[model samples]
Every structure is written in C-alpha cells, then in structure tokens.
Target: MEFWTGLYLMSFLNMACCLPKSSYTVYLNKLSFSTAQSHCLPGSFLANIPKEEEMAEILKTIWDKNDKTATSFWIGLQKNKGDCYRKDLPLKGFYWTVDSSTQSDVKLWETEPSNTCLELRCGLLSVKYGETAATCNGFVETTCRQEHPFICKRNATVTCRRPDILGTHDIIDYSNDKDTCYVHCASGANFTLKCSKDLVWTVLGNQNMDTSQLCLECNKGYRRDASGYCVDVNECEESKPCTHRCLNTDGSYKCACSDNDMDDCDGSKPPTTDLTRNDYSNVNRGKSLLTQPTSLPDDVRTNETDVHIEESVGDVSNIIVPVIIALLIFIVLLVIVAAIVKGCIRRRTTKLSRRKAEAVALNGSNSMEKVNEKEET
Candidate 1:
C-alpha cells in the first residue's frame, strides 16, 4: 500500500481507506497507456487501484460524469515483457507503475487470462457489463498499445504551520519548494524541517529545540566556544580593565579594590606610613616608577602605594611653597615702609636745627643794634 494511504487509514480515520476522493482526476481524452503515463508527470502519476475501495471511488467518479461513450480506463498496473509470471503472488508478477511494492488480495479481475505467461500487458477498468452491478469488479488485462481514457493520482498539497516555539532572536524561512523550512538562531546556528508527503512535519536531523544550541551570536559578556556552545567570557583574564582586581559573572564582569577602605576599584587612597617607607625603599633600589606594576612581592611596595605617596608629597609641596612666598613678600613691604619713616624723621630734625640757628642769629643782631643806638644818644 502507498505510504499516504496507510497513514490515512491508521492515523487519519476521517479520511478514506486508500487515496482520498479528491486525489483522483479522470481525463476523457483517449491515449495509449504509455502516453497516458507520460501525461501525468512532474507532480502526479497514473492511479494505482491496490484496493477495492479505491476502485469503487474511481467508478463513482466515472458514473458522475454520466458519459455513455466512456467504457474503459487505464490504471497504473503494468507488466514488463521480460518479467516472468508468478502465480502464487497476489498480483501475479504484475506491479503498480507508481509503486512496484503495492499488493492486493482482492480478486477484481472479470476473467482469468488464458495465456498467463504473456507480457507487455496493462490493467484496465471496464464498466460495459453494468454500472449497478453488485461487485463492480471489471479489471481487464490488455495490451499497452490500446488507447483509453485514464485516471491520475496526486497527493494534496499541505502546508506545515509555522512553529511558535522560537526564541525572540530566532528567524524562520521557507524554501521555494514550500516543503522545506530553515530555522536561523541568533547564536549563529541553523536547523531544518521538512513537510512529509503524508502531511506530517519532521525535523531533518533530530535536532533539539534548545536555545543554547540554536544561538549563533551569544549575549553580552558571553562568547561562543570551540564546541559551538555559549560560554561565559572572562573579562578579567582578557582585557584586565580593573586597576586592583576583577571578577567574572554570568554575562558580565566586575572590578574590586584590594583595600577595604577604598570607595572605588581605582586604588585611589593615601598611603600609610609602612607603605610610604616601602615605596622609598623600592625607589632607593633603582626600580623604574614610570609605569605602574600590576603585582608586587610582599616585601616590595606596590605601584598603587607609590602613587599614593607621590600624591601626598605633591599636595604638601603645593601648599607650603605658596605660604613661604607670601611671607617673603610681606617682609619686603615692611622694610620699605620702615625706610620711608626713618628718612622723614631725619628731615624733620634737620628743619628744627636750622630754625634754632636762625632764631639765635636774629637775637644777637637785635642786641648789637640796641647797644649802638644807646652809644649814639
């Protein structure tokens, strides 16, 4: 039996036993058996009546046409010239052209063939006896060269509905054939699905729908490994963006300072006395301090401690230098004011002395004048 036919009978109980009623099409134009077979190509083939129910369906179709001129029709059953007859076989060495494995136990032949070993024979269904016959069995064996109207069978086109079980970043695409579907995931992975002839959808490689395997590009702070799995990215090992310490998380990273007193991870704090002493010792040992070292021994000073010491010394100098300059400026102004006061005192003393001398000279002149006037009188 055909795969679709068996599936319909076993799984889809609502459908007909063999091919569905809609699957068959009758062509009234008469043509040879080979020509008829060729006519149903690309998507269909000649009808295979492997069961009596299918033959009854074909007969009903012919009766519905109500054409008295139509008497016989070619089916898909045929026997090659070189094939030997097998009496024990259900089909007697004959096979359905559509599927050679098809078999039937129901005897629908009108009469047994006289030459059982004859070849190049094809199957035909005749209704000349009577349309209302109880058996409706009119299977006839005839030459391939005979011209007759034939029937073709094709599977109904069925669409596999889109699956809603996809991630937000997943994409779905249908192929030109419409039977194939491809799934693209954000993690740079892909899977395939196919619409089977029996109207069923199946995954191509039995792939699971897990998001871990479907993603192509991982989320932030995550990366794809060699085995195509999304793994956590260790930013601390790769870029070392932290100044003191680094910690890795599920999808991100964090930085931390070794000193508990420090508010941030940048190592920004004043150095203690021990740290200052160690910094000087390291400086005396002739170690280059231009670049900050990431790590140091217990005895040696760390670069962060050195930086704190340098900053503290710089801050002290920045304050003391300005105070000393202000004191010097104040002394210079005091000396200039004292010199002006001393010069003013000397000028005042000199002016006082000159006034005293002039006054004495005037007194002497006055006394002499008085004496001379007395002598004259």
Candidate 2:
C-alpha cells in the first residue's frame, strides 16, 4: 500500500525543511548558509552518522509497509573535514528514508578539502571551490534532475525518547580532546551542565546535554533563510512592518522613527512612555501615514499595504540607512584590513578589549591623583 507522499527535502543538516512539494525535485550541489538555515529540520537534525542510522530505521519501516520502488535521493554523509561536508549519493540514490547507514552502498565524502582552514562544503558531496556563500533564495547549479525515487521526511517523530532521551544531540568534536564529543541539548531543554568542548562526551545513557532540538533557522532578517542556507537574522522582516525604521541585531531586531523608537526591549511596539517621550511629535504628525495599521475595512484601504508600508518605513530609514551604510562601509573596511592583517588582525581583536580596559584604569588613576592634589591645596 504505497501512496505518494509529498517530499520536503533538507538541503543541509542544520537548515530548515524545504517546503513539501506537490511534485518537486532537488539535486543539491551547493547549499549555502541560508540553505542550511532554510532546509534544516524544524527542531534539530542529527548531524552524526549514528543518529542518521536511527532515522533510517524509521524510514525503512515506512518503505517496508509500502509497496513502491526505492527512489533516488540524497542523504547527509560526507567526509569529516573540520568544515561542512556532504557525501556522494549512492548509485541507487539513497534517501533520508533509508534506515541502514552501514550498508555497503552507502557513500562517503573525501576527507581533505582544505589545506589548513574550514571554508568549503561537506556531506553528500564536497564543493571544490571555496565557499562563495549566498542567501537561501539564490539559485545555483545542481546535479542532473532525473527522477529516481522520492524521500519523505516528516518532522522528527515527537522524540520517542520520553522513555529514553527526549531531544536530539548537537555533537561537536571535543576541541581539546579529539576522542571525546561535546554534546549540547537543543530545543531549549533546561539542561545546564555546560561541558567544555573537550569535556563533552557522548553516551548510550547517563549524563550529558540532551540536544533534543537541532539548531533552527532564524527568522528573516537578523536571521535570514538564504537560498538553501540559514544566515544572519535579517532584521528587515522582524522589524514590525508598521514601524518607520527597522534595524536588525544579532538575535533580534528593532524599529524606530526619528527622535523616537517604536521598538521595545523585547522588540515589540513600545508603551505610552515611548509615545509621550517622542520629541518629533509634530514631525510625526506631518509625515505620511506609513506606520499606521492598515487593518481598516478593505474598501477604505485602497492603497496597497506594501506601498504604504514602504512609505512609512522610508522616513525612519534616514537614520537607519546611514547606520546601515556606515555598517557596510565599516564591514568593507574591515574586510580589506583583514585581508591585509590576516591572523595578526584576528589575534589583535581578541586582545583589544583587555588593552582598552587597561588604558581606562591608568587614566582613572591619574584623574584620582589630580583630584587629591587639588583638594589638598
């Protein structure tokens, strides 16, 4: 009894799941950071072969119960380069649904793609050139799109670990000790035994961080879903569409208008204090009504909300635009400088804060001495 199930493929292990296709084909060659974020599973995905083996068993159950030929598909199994690695696709085309990772047909990726650093793709296959990373939506070449078999990946079944471990594991090779693996429990599970990368060890049972949830894709802006990867959160989308100025941060975003911020601490609209403290009260009134909520009756709201949203957003953008520009300029400058400085630059930046603190202490001591002399006189 094999019925066609919509396939939702994940281009990368730590990215979001691709939308379930009515009839779609994915031959991933290079999934970018955004791809990693976008196609990553909803919760967490197993990045280890052992875990994938568990996942494959579940797949086998479904295939065994169904009456259909196995489809050609891709699974994550690349060489263990200290970077992202994807393995080659097996000839029969192994899908994530296959349960046996140890099968002879399983392909493995080549180990050494880099000379000294981490800057390439891994898993099903390795991208030869260096990372020219792009956003999730960006399009690139893929392997031939010949139809083989289909892969069906539903959300990880509610961790069957209630009787066992209730979450997925984030395994990092112990940096200090290669033999051990530092595991972290994702899904926001409240396990607080932060083990050093060296101290972290995997277990068939007992104590360790339960990585129930895999790293999830951050929302657009601040965290963006690039072509087939997860990227810096795109603050552009998270900023309330109703606000005038939107700025993105590492984990969150903010919105503002000249002389007033529409953003609150939690990144939501502000309270009356924010409104009353606004100095641009008159300027705000005279400005176009871009920030106004457009939930009015559909007839009265004739103008496209998108256009209005743009208009409202345009004003506060003055401040943010300069900041954005400045940030970009700064980034460009940093890149150029970095290209020149390389390892030295990285080392200096690491130690810079300490230098600044030391300078501040010396200045404070001099100021205190001067104050004491003046008081004595």
- Alpha-carbon lDDT, every model: 0.66, 0.38
Error of 1 at 152 (Å): 1.2
Q: List candidate 2 segments past 4 Å from native.
A: 1-37, 44-48, 51-118, 125-377
Best by lDDT: 1
How close to the true structure is residue 285 of candidate 2, measured as C-alpha lDDT? 47
Give the per-residue lDDT of model 1 (tens digit) for 269-354.
Answer: 22222344455555546456434343444334555566668778999999999999999999999999999999999999898667
> Clashing pairs in model 1?
186-216, 186-217, 187-215, 187-216, 187-217, 188-215, 188-216
Query: In terms of TM-score, how similar is model 2 to the real structure?
Result: 0.17
TM-scores, all models, native as reference: 0.36, 0.17
Most TM-score-accurate candidate: 1
Model 1: residues with Cα > 4 Å off, grouped in runs: 1-22, 114-118, 129-135, 157-377
